[model samples]
Target: MVGIVVVSHSRKAAEGIRDVATEMGGDARVEAVGGTGDGRIGTSPEPISRAIADAADGNGVVVLVDLGSAVMNAEIAIEEAELEEEVVLADAPVMEGALNAAVAAGAPDATVDSVRMAAEDAQRVKKFG
Candidate 1:
């Protein structure tokens, strides 16, 4: 199964997205990485990477982040780990991408390619509309 990680500045946001995705995806692998420095759920690159690695196992990972910092941190984590699992940092809007990924994951033929395509399509819609 495809693994998805949602990174945001707020824990609630990450959790909320995960909940929605889970409802749609049904048993899909979903994790959260929230920013630190506040009372909210927080995490660093290392922990996020570890979560991604663990969820990925051997399949692959798709990371969705809220902002520039979150994206950068996730990227750094991916680079540092050098994991074999294909990691894709989605440029799509957080909620939309997560939902799209969830839908893709629900498919019996879900693959990294399909999930990436869903993410890209979602991003395009967000960008255009």
Candidate 2:
């Protein structure tokens, strides 16, 4: 099964997103990464990466970040972990990307590539001129 890691500055945001994804995903694996740095806003990469690793198991991991630091941190964590599983970072808008990822995860043929595709599509939908 595919694994999802949602990263946000506030624990609440991450948790909330995770809750929505969990509801949509059913038994699929979905994890949250939050409360990093000052806790005001911005997640640390280490914990986020760890969460991804745990959720990934053998399958690859898909990471979705809320903003700047969260993205940087997640990237750093992924590098530090040296995880064997493929880790795809979603450049899509947080909410749409996360929802798409959740749906992809629940799909029978869900994979990191599929999730990434869904996230990219969501991002396109969210993009503004």
Candidate 3:
């Protein structure tokens, strides 16, 4: 069971994405980390790391980032977390990728690399008409 971590510059956006992923039905652990400690429009590594720890249930974790500093912060968090579970970053759209990853994570045989690939492949699915 792979877990997912959503990182965004806006707290609401990250949490909203997590809610949707959760509602989609998955056994994976999903968590969101966003906004600065002061609630400013920025990302922090500390909370992001904690989110990864919280979501990871021994299995590795996959991270989906919104944009801008979120990427850098996620990378930092991955290193800072330093958990035994491997953490991988997906280069895909935030919400869609998170949902895709969550679905993959739900699989009984989901792996960190597989979940990351699923999230990255989400870029192929068009969102609108």
Candidate 4:
């Protein structure tokens, strides 16, 4: 199954999204890397790489970010990690995308691309009118 990483300026936000994803993901590999690594409001590449490494399975990892530097930092983290497994940055709603990706990724047969597609597809979903 693919893995998932959540990135946000707020550690609480990241952890909250991870908690919800956890409830929906079943056995998926999900991890969160957020804040300035000092309980501040910001994003950094350092812990992001660690989270990617920790979350990554043989199926790779999909990263979801809140905004601004979180996306930029996540990109840098992926580049710096130089991981053998692929890391994809998702341009979708952080909470919803992570939940969708996590659920899709929990399947043993799920691939990195498929999990990413799930996150992307999540953006198109309409909750209600």
- Best TM-score among the predictions, by candidate number: 4
Clashes of 4: 0
TM-score of each: 0.86, 0.88, 0.94, 0.95
In model 1, what are the clashing residue pairs, if there are any? none
Q: What's the distance in Å from true for residue 89, model 3?
A: 0.6
The Cα local distance difference test for each model comes to 0.80, 0.81, 0.89, 0.90
Worst 10 residues of 2 by lDDT: 36-45
Residue pairs clashing in model 3 are: none
Give me the runs in candidate 2 sitting further than 4 Å from their true place. 37-40, 126-129
**Displacement of the residue 17 alpha carbon in candidate 4, Å:** 0.3
lDDT of 2 by residue, 6-119 (tens): 888888988898898778777768788788556666677668867887887788888888887888988898788787878888888777788888888888888899987897
- For model 4, residues 31-111, the per-residue Cα lDDT tens digits are 987999778999989999999999876678899999999989999999998988889898889989999998998776788
Poorly placed runs, candidate 4 (over 4 Å)? none
Candidate 1: list runs displaced more than 4 Å: 37-43, 126-129
Ordering by TM-score:
4, 3, 2, 1
